[model samples]
Target: MAAVPLSLQVGERKFTTTKATLSKSGFFSALLAGPWEGDLLMDGSYFIDADPDIFDFVLKYLRHGILPLFYDKVKGHDYRLYLAVLEREHILGHFASPFHKISIIRKRIDEYGFILIWEARYFQVESLEKWIHDKTYLKAIKSTHRASEVDRIQDVSRSFSSELDVEYHTSWKTEKIYICPRRIFVHRGNPEACGRQCKQAQGTAEPEYEEELTVKALAIEKETTFNFEICMDDDR
Candidate 1:
């Protein structure tokens, strides 16, 4: 009910933050929603078996909602270590090829940038994931030197069309729970079903009208308010 101070032990390193801040991450929110014997440590801190170095970036995202731009480098931060962490967490998948050439269009992205986006998605940070997608996805595509302007545009459009489920006569749908790059979209009412009753719906679709919405709807059904009052229960 209150802002609980949280100490996280990663390997030999210890990091501290408030439960409210940690709740920004869906992973941490679920982990802290109730008591768990596996995560608790004798030192009154939650033990997270992850690399503390890479987790520093994760904490920054939770505390400040920091979304780094493509190609932007953090001073004193090694990108290679970040990659290693992703590999260890299985965020990079079986191979690094999928991340390097993202999307079915095979658009190449900066490995570091893709890693950051993947990390946000992995943590289930909806806002941050959408921010990175909206702010950087196209820019990265545009800056790619492998393709010509027209080719890049066509490829990008086709790539996004498939990802966002673009349809000729139906309303395009935005993902309610998952976040994907170049996939944030406004959900206009189903044109094919407009002004029609549910029974008279077009094709096999139900006549359902929905308005344009952002990815914020991803967390709309969840309680996000965090009490700022500090909880002093050390035993917790």
Candidate 2:
């Protein structure tokens, strides 16, 4: 007599396969070993209360050692379902770039990639868990460096625009530009020195300076090659 094939009913769907193929999984191996003989049906088909869709992947893997691939039709929830099935079936150490494929689906799911990593650990998928941990560490370092660069730029901008405005006064005679602080400007003949002494009155916040420098800067000869525009922010 021909041998009777092993039959299984997962959820609403029924399936038939050989004992040799189904026994590839330890869970199935135990089930076939008669420990759960009380649960076997009269027709000899084992009825499993599982999602047939997710269990289909495991059946294929048992038969041919094939793993799930990222296809256009595959959705983010499918990845989670696949992982859950693998865990339920006591499958381990058999991931073929699963996390990488899941990453492609992550864009549509939003934040699902991180959750998948945690699931990887929960399901004891060691290879995928390590890969996600390493990638997350590197991404965190990059984010910190990027934030630091933005802060540095803002600090430099603030310092340049802070109190005590810097003004440029050009002297045509020496063809040099004088960096005069505040309202002070260089005299016509001496391009290196301020036209007046900047005297700070004792116990006063303001610097008392003669108006002689402003008058001299305005009186500069018009034959100058380039004129430097002066701007001051009194509020600072």
Candidate 3:
């Protein structure tokens, strides 16, 4: 279909963009896949009924494939709003968290630098019972931190080779930011999943192990193309 010059009454103001522009989004592309006759107002521009404040970010992400990353702009409920729009659009997985939920990654300033403090995702590192049962969990966090130290080590004097770094590191003291993780968990899912059951995960080095992955993903933000994507409409 030809691109329609779409306009939406967001809050009280009007924002205009092309259907082709919005269609770069997996969400908006699907919404605009068919004729939008009645969605148009008297002015002949398609009207979107959505939270205008939130929709600005939505449209931005749609048009540019990036959610704003500024700490001030994207603080508090901004992420949840993004998740709300994405989930309602049935495109949450398009920008999924490692756990496939609305996990919070905070930029924490410390002596080490701005390390990513994964706010919502937490795993039990130990407890009175778990301490006696699982000392290996503590050891692993220390080991992983040590292992990720090279950040990347290359033997630059020999034959030229390129490789992707799979190693990751998080602070050994997660408690500095994450607070106290629950001692025992009967469920084995992410934070949102645990919240659904009114519980949190507890056991072993798994949560700490998983934290390694989260930190790695955040650490590679500058070095990798993991930030955003130009979403195309699915053939399905």
> What is the lDDT of every predicted structure here?
0.45, 0.41, 0.39
Clashes of each: 0, 0, 0
TM-score for all predictions? 0.38, 0.36, 0.33
Instruction: Please give the range of 10 consecutive residues that has the lowest summed lDDT in model 2.
Output: 224-233
Which residue runs does candidate 1 get wrong by more than 4 Å? Answer: 69-122, 130-236
Q: Which residue runs of candidate 2 sit more than 4 Å off their true CA positions?
A: 1-4, 73-78, 86-110, 113-236
Q: Which runs of model 3 end up more than 4 angstroms from their true locations?
A: 1-4, 73-236
Number of the top TM-score candidate: 1
How many backbone collisions does model 1 have? 0
Per-residue lDDT over 1-236 for candidate 1, one digit per residue giving the tens place of the 0 to 100 score: 77668798875799989988888766667667777676689988887655566677667757765443323221423444444333333442333332132221222347655433232213445554454434432232221112122212223334332212222222234433322122223323324223334334344643343344332211111111212221111222
The per-residue C-alpha lDDT of model 2 at residue 163 equals 18
Model 3's lDDT to the true fold?
Answer: 0.39
lDDT of 3 at 146: 17
Which pairs, if any, clash in model 1? none
Model 3 poorest 10 in a row by lDDT: 120-129
lDDT of 2 at 124: 32
